[model samples]
Target: MLENIRENSQGLVAKIILGFIILTFAVAGIGSYTNSVDTSVAEVNGEKISQAEFEKAYQTQRARMAQQFGEMFETLSNDANYMAQMRDSVVENLVNQLLVDQASRDMAIRISDERIKQTIREMPAFQVEGQFDNNRYLARINQEGFYQSSDFRDYLRVEMTRRQLTQALVSSEFALPYQTSLLTTLQNQKRDIRFATISAKQFEQGVEVTEAEINDYYLANPGRFENQEKVKVNYIALDVNDLAKDIEVNDSDLESYYQQNIVNYRQPEQRRIAHILIEFGDDKATAKTKIADIQTRLNNGEDFGELANALSDDTFSGENGGDLEWFEAGINGEAFDQAVTALTDVNAVTDIVESESGFHLIKLTEFKAEQVKTLADVKEEIAIAVSTQKAQDKFFELQQQAAQLSFEFPDSLEDAANAVGVEVKTSAWLSRFGNAAPFDNAKVIDAAFSDLVLNERLNSDIIEVSDSLVLVVRLNEYQAANTKPLEQVSEQIKTILVQQKSAEKAQLLADELLATHKAGDDISAQLTANNASFEEKAAVARYGSDLDASIVREAFKLPHPVADAVVATTVKLNNGDIALIEVTAVSQGDEQAPASFEQQYSQQLAQAAYQSYVEALREQAEISKRENITSTSQL
Candidate 1:
């Protein structure tokens, strides 16, 4: 279990720290400080992990995990083993971070202030309406309990510097030509074969099993027969939907609401506009002179479409002579949009409008006027609103009646249902964690497991399942743990035996098909006669775009196509079918593949080499730090 946990470090760590932090901050959140504290727990060279620093770092990790998991924290917090695993991860992460920080200082790695600001401005979290918002940035920092912007900036700078150093150390490593060629050779391969599977249903019809064998299997697996805890509850429910149906919407109020929100009933006029654009940067004066020349040509009655096609900097619309499709107000830049909207008629041309995208000479090709919808046109919408309100009112009325009955009777769900004019619903017997029927809701299951309902046999309190439904329940009776009799489980055991035999038969048939193909017997005719399709995938790369890379990798390892060295492979599908493959052809290409495909494979190989280098560096650094820490503590 620990080995599996180690393999999934990120998932395990996230689960462990799901809820602990209400008051601590992680080192990543800490601002810069020049002074070292004496209460350091461990040091990487002269750098210290002070007790205060550790507490802060721990708290930040806790808060981050809590936010990510939200309400699921209860499930994680209840697991003691998971929590312990998370603590170990936190310590390891902190130690590695300290080492990396110290190494950056020793190597004199520094990140520029401009780079730090640029990174912060690009962060998606600090953006408001698609652009960086200063107020949002400050609010986020304040929410995280940071006092100053410079403090957060300095921390980010150090982390960035450390990352740069790691990248620099690892980037030079590359895979050898021999390794690359071997990988490519293994990718370009194909499989061809004919096969059939003997399904379990085919053999299950006539299969027989003795009663004694079923009894023996049941006796050996007593844990499977143990009765799970169950519950019943008696309660009252308040359904909002029922109440909403009885509520009324007055005609005057509907008219008033419509008048107040009249804008919703009207559609704004839109215009189709296009423009010849000239962009300006540092050479603003030169760009202005060029734009003026184009305007002069246009004033002289030169063809706008011809001039735009030849002179426009907007490539996206230039090919169509600067013809942009229809757009509503606020769709384009404010200055450009305002100028276009001001045009009084279709085919109107406006003076050059300056915007962030540069200067644009606008042409309005078409226009649409606003159209307002009448009250009669939206009657169905009003009807729905009225019905929803009435249903909510009725639901609450039912809840009040049921609540009164529960109070009066104090013992029966039936009495409460009778008082509310609703039917009493009883659920089938269900295990505590089993999804047996409608009673499978987690909240309902938790309520069913409560001591009062499960053991005391008392009526459950009214519980809200959703806004529209409420339920009261009670445990009727519980079955105790006992081994199921042989007669009860005989059919299940027989089915299992049939499936096992079917799988073995399928494997045998697949093996024979491969053997026949290897012996130079053509199976294409047999496959075609059986209505099985044959596909030929040529020049398949190791990192195949369409097929699974793992499948392609295995396929390429077979002997050359001419040799007919068939390699049998079986793919275990999620749906219980074994996809048997027999390799028929294999080939290797010398050149790097196309740019789009080659780049992805190159990056994968490069990253793997880089990660291996970083791990080696980290291991050596850790060993040296451990020795030094031990010596200092002894002293």
Candidate 2:
């Protein structure tokens, strides 16, 4: 093959192939060759949304859902359909963000850096006692997954710009007076209605399921009585909180830990300085020459602030006399720190310093001297840290031993529990789709019902239920899937058949009454004469009805009474009974919709319009998505 290719390379055919290859590289670059596999969850207009980006976005979305749904989050997450929706939501959000960024760029929507900084400064989370706190701002952004202030600034700019676009679309939407009027008329429409309830219980008394009928239905639906394969699990749980309770820290331990970690307790010397930076752009000689000229000016008693404002490459600090703010050693690099630390007096200037960032001319404005604390000041904090460290070390040892024992002795978890000095706990009956308490988590459930544990009858390897909780399980009792005896479910079958027949009888009576009313005979009189109560409700709104909610919904679903004639219909009630609902009159509210309601409704319509706008943009945009990567083997 090599010889053939080599000989062909001199021919016209090979030359044509080589030309195409070169052109491909010219268009796509060498990255196209290196990245043999595409790892993007989605792509919009050739911009790839990498899998890592999707995972991060998914985590953020999951956290939001956890916060929003609270106790329901766990159950919802376990629901395959809901989780699929959640994954879809994450992908949609990523795609929408890319779309927004692309559209924003095309439309020239850009927020100023100063505006970004101002937005951060004004955030309530970053404020301390009604004032912006720099430390608080930094800590808050760090918690939000942006460790760098600049990164946070960029994030805020994008988010703010997105909000601006959304507001633009919303503000442009308007609901006309006629639109509001029509909406209010429909929303405030009232129906004067009456209903006659014919209870299923009246028919149920006469409907009976014989033994033969029960047997026949039970035989027909055999799978309905089949129980889910379940296991009663006896397992051992190890929790960090329980282990830490017995581990004690003495005064000697605290003294030793405090001394070993003394640097953490001491405050580093902070230096406040201003500097003019000229990056190594275009040519090293040009940058060097610029820095040297700045140094000469500084040496000749020239204004450093004015020079920085005019010549510094860092525009952010340049605008403020190149103030780099307060920072400690090792923060501004070793070379820069050496110059700042060597300054003896305030207003001391250093010669041009060369660092990885580029050339810098440092000017010292002020400094805060380092402070060391005695053992008494941070005694409590030290004690806690030392104690936690010791507990963690012991916990780690037990964690390893328990996992090893569970795996080595796969038949039982007792040995592992005893070795770790943890209690062996047991769980009530648990099936593939259901469990209780600690075992209720999806990960633990998956591990419990695994082939190794459920089929092979082996102990589970250590499962991390949470960061602090670990578990190893073995099947105590297993019940294979089996159908219940006919005798056991006979009563259940009877009740079902009885309900079916009773409901049919109820519907038949309702249909007959409805037919008579439609044929011009009053059925309400006959119902009342037969000892059936006619429940009459007047001026019933969409809500706040005394009738069954389902009936109210059905009544509202009914058309308005026409030409001074009553409208009647038959609807199946939720309780398996049937009701004859009659609407005598229908009326709309005389008053106009309130300002607040009109505003809210208009905003709702605007939101719907904005969504349509986004959909339209999506229709025009070229989008490719990978669905298989959305699921995890074990969530």
Candidate 3:
């Protein structure tokens, strides 16, 4: 009976038994009612971390990882430590999700169906032309293997609730001003210095090497000497675009589509306006006074364009007399747009409007009223849209025909092609692992390597390369692997020897230069005579430009720069030039910062603190996980 219970524990019968036992005890205080209920794997909190749920989550994670890494998945699975790490990661993620669900229940954080709908409507993926596309949304959901919209919506709701809980926890944490200021200062501080480089190329002209040494090096590295095999293949590719070009759209179709979707052809109302913007200074009262003075000037008949040219801080627009040039509604902030749109007359000046940028006085120059476009105006667009639809439908028909052909003549490519009214084409000699011509599809390559093609002269099954077309291929011939003689690689070996000798000579010269500089000997004349230039860098902070940041970090660790004392630094340039640098100076910058900058810095620190707090919470949430159960297991 115990063995049977263990085997059937994942079935619906076991769930019914467990449910019956709980209900029987609750109603009548029944004791020892069920001998078949296996509850040993249940959690201390009375929540069943069902074997099925664990296996599903585990398999999902495994498949995701395998898809991401491909062939490397096998290598990763072979390692015990890697498997353990993956298991732990999956378990942690499952536990966090469970904890989020518990927290949502405890806090009564309800996500409404309407909110989920609104969220989906707002999502850019589901939107077409700035509005939610119901067909596109449904099609995308269907493609993801969900049978119903309600199921997908429920998943989205759970995710949204989890996100809200995380946001709440983060918002509750506070960061201090002092911490913000320190971080801001660190972020903004810049470093300034002077340095010179000694390159390997400068000393490489004198280096010499023998053939015996090169031959010995090559002998020691046989694997590196092996050449990779390459092959050329011939194939007829069937791409969707190819079929789309051949598909035609008539005038009637275009006109019909344009009439059906008229809203898509209408343009929004737009306005052309100019403005005189006055930004607030440090003090609000003083800034307001300055703004009032600007308003008085505008009222007293001062040219708005001339005033904007003089006072506007927006460099891009200021040059053109604050002309923002044909802005549509909602392009600018709501306040600015409302103020601009309120002006009925072309010469009318707007009253002072306040925004984050500052107070703004505007003038309406010109406005283009919205127009519902005629069929002629959008003929080209309509034609393209209609053509695309026709092409898709034709492609679907072709796929059906090809599928039929494949069914009738499963063993012959020629017979299938004859049935579909298309010519049969043969591919050039291709190896099992060779790249498929034009289309590097794994499916095509796998078809080429199937037992029928590799060992027997059997035609490949119809392989759908893409949405538009299917391919049926038969292997023609095969090529055996070949190795090149050692004599063929002798020239390559000679070039390698030359580069090695050059690099060694350059290193020796760089070492001597460093020693000479350390001994307080002036080498600037020698450096200048060799056509080398000195680069002066300033205020390069830790997270500055990549090159300067790397150099600065290394230079600061060295002793203070002194006259004739060069701190030699070797860096590899992207152009294959090896640079050996001499550090001339290094100095720390001032650490004073503004209050706003400090606040921004503190926000970043708070985010990091919140992440650490969440990780701690997840660790404290005790979770036990089971694995390898069948789909029949119930929660």
Candidate 4:
């Protein structure tokens, strides 16, 4: 089998293609805005940005945030208002990118075919067993809506140019030494503070949640106590690997393919050559005589290495027994190349050749002409290639058939399965947030929950589950959304009610205590009188302190204390507790700033420059959203 083509980061692609986006945004702390949709939802300087396009970009960002937010993703996504704001943010991001994309067009940059292919090779999604699978790459591009490879290449060209432009802007930015020094000093600055915790749990024992409170909370928040609707689907899968097994590759097919793509078989010319040189000596005549004698001795079968090492005046080659490394054509100047080429046979010494340098004797140590693999040598590889292509062609045919047949016979997937030569299979229960593969794929879940399949009891549209698998599914089993029993959630409701009351108590007390302290009633005296407790931490560095990070961040953001007066504030902790913080002193960092500070600050400023440049572009641009589509921008 042919080895996988190597994945290479293309230098040319970096120069002319989308270098700017990845280079700047990924390193500049703005990477989350890299992907967006491109059709007619909005217009930037007259280019259409469709709602569908915007939604695609929004989903991509959501998926990325899901990874970053982890446990918080569920809470954030479930909040309709938050998700709406996120969509508008996505629109803003998309518009910025579109501006860059439009600017890139003015530069008229392009990506070469080889570089685009290299990019495809480097994507792990197109690989199998650590090797780039050409079929998978093609199929994936097809699924993504680029029907032709050249069309995909053109898309890459447009995308790459945009990044190249942004990267150029970011690359040209720099931070001066004084700027970094100042920033590092401020960033590493220390603060001195005393703080006291008002634990919500302390008030919880006295916070009695009555039965009426639990019932009211549960009834008001019904959605929170309900189970997610789940469903099971039966589907027909058309897999490319199964189709490939059915393909019968003939010898003639391999031969024809080899002849059609003969360029891939070439092995360039190679040679190992050597020479003995007699640089014009004290007398040119003497050098000529000496080279002629050396040639005669070589012709008489004197050991070439021994004679050349002993007498050749080209001392570098002489030290290596007159052996030069492998020869490349037109490299050593015309005379030397001609002399080496003129030697007719391997080991045959050339005639006394006089050059500007001196007289020379040359020998062809080894030679190999350009090569092409014959059909017999690569028949197995060719067969595999031919069969895979044929299988892919069949898969496309069946994919279309499955889609059409399922649509034509909308009542069930049986007709489509029969037509596509695949058996009907069933999937287990899955929810909207399922993470199981195959059925859990976003496309599959979307299709399964679509109105046609779920409500109408009709066959779903064919979903491309992966590069190799195509599916058409129908509803089999369904679970309706329902709330849990009152008895089942009573204890959970009680806990929630208790926590809410406790947090209110803690906040009210913390606020009163803060007010009393700010009115010149010394906090220490007030705490002592109330038999309350407090902890004093000195010299709390901005980073790596034993105190809560949220508190630390807030503490640093607070204003520095004036002499004889402390800076004080109340902060909410993650545990629903409240803390009272009093800053007694603040001090600048005295240590030498780290070397990385300059580069880090430079990138930070570069990112800011990029954003400012994009914002300027937006101001100049005529951006319009669809009248019906409401987003945070309109708000």
| Best model number under TM-score | 2
* TM-score of each model, in listed order: 0.55, 0.77, 0.51, 0.48
Arrange candidates by TM-score, highest first: which order?
Answer: 2, 1, 3, 4
lDDT ranking, high to low: 2, 4, 3, 1
lDDT of each: 0.63, 0.82, 0.65, 0.79
> What are the per-residue Cα lDDT tens digits for candidate 4 across 390-494?
999999999999999999988888888888898999888889874577765778888888888889999988788888998889999999889999999999999
Summarize candidate 3's per-residue lDDT along 1-635 as a digit string, tens digits.
99997889879988899999989777664444544455322242345655555567778878899999875676687787777677667555666667767777779998987788779879998777996654455456766654345557878988899888877776666656566556556556554555555455555575665668767767876666664432222223344566787887788898889988998988867677877666554666666677678778888999878888887644335557777666545433589889988887887888887765567777888877888989998899888888888877776676566666655655565555555456766665554354554335656766766776656656666677766666766656654455445577667777777776666655565566566766768767765765555677665566646564446666555565566455666554443344445555454444566656655655676688767765765676665555422232222
What lDDT tens digits, residue by residue, belong to model 2 across residues 437-501?
68777777878788888789998888888777888888888888999999899989999999989
Off by over 4 Å in 3: 1-48, 55-88, 99-165, 202-438, 449-451, 454-458, 475-485, 525-533, 538-568, 574-578, 582-607, 618-624, 627-635
Model 4 misplaced stretches (Cα beyond 4 Å): 1-181, 210-229, 242-373, 386-425, 440-442, 458-462, 481-491, 512-533, 544-546, 561-566, 599-635
What lDDT score goes with residue 429 in model 2? 88
List candidate 2 segments past 4 Å from native: 1-163, 208-226, 279-291, 328-345, 349-359, 404-414, 432-436, 482-487, 529-531, 590-595, 615-635
Looking at model 2, residue 128 earns an lDDT score of 69
